[model samples]
Target: MLNMLGISAGIAVAAYGEARFDAFGVMLQLVTITAEATRLVLIQILLTGATPPPAPAPAQADRDVEMGLLGGESSASRPVMKPQPGS
Candidate 1:
């Protein structure tokens, strides 16, 4: 809030110095235009936050089913493959 006021004051002073009073008024309009756009963008980003989409649910397996649809049933878990940069 205060930051925007500072910016407004600075622009008013500078525009008045560089141009006439009418031109300064025109420049001030631009300040409000940009400030409004900035405020809206900030509000949208803040409301959304950094939320990630929910992941899909895992497929449920039946213990009594005995085997996978592919007929491959392993008592041990699958090995986790670590990636190598070159390979």
Candidate 2:
């Protein structure tokens, strides 16, 4: 028999690691890091940026996305969409 198991790890990880896995956040991070690392290497192997890199933004910035998923009606304090008369 084929069985599927749904562990809470994914949910927990997503909740905790939103910045790294989120599209708007870390999707570009991999690409950018690679380029920066390569450029730094080319220019000077020992060169390093003095200032720290900016903090990564969460892919799912709004917690409402997870909250609103219970149904079409979103309970998030911040409305992702304008409230319409009806669906």
Instruction: Output the number of the TM-score-best candidate.
Output: 1
Superposed model 1: Cα runs more than 4 Å off: 1-21, 51-87
Per-model tally of clashing residue pairs: 0, 0
- Over 4 Å off, model 2: 1-21, 45-87
- Please tell me which predicted candidate would have the highest lDDT against the true structure: 1
Give the distance in Å from residue 49's predicted Cα in candidate 2 to where it truly belongs. Answer: 21
Report the lDDT of model 1 for residue 50.
Answer: 60
Candidate 1 structure lDDT = 0.72
lDDT of model 1 at position 29:
92
**Residue range 16-67, candidate 1, lDDT tens digits:** 8666557767889999999999999888888989666775334323531345
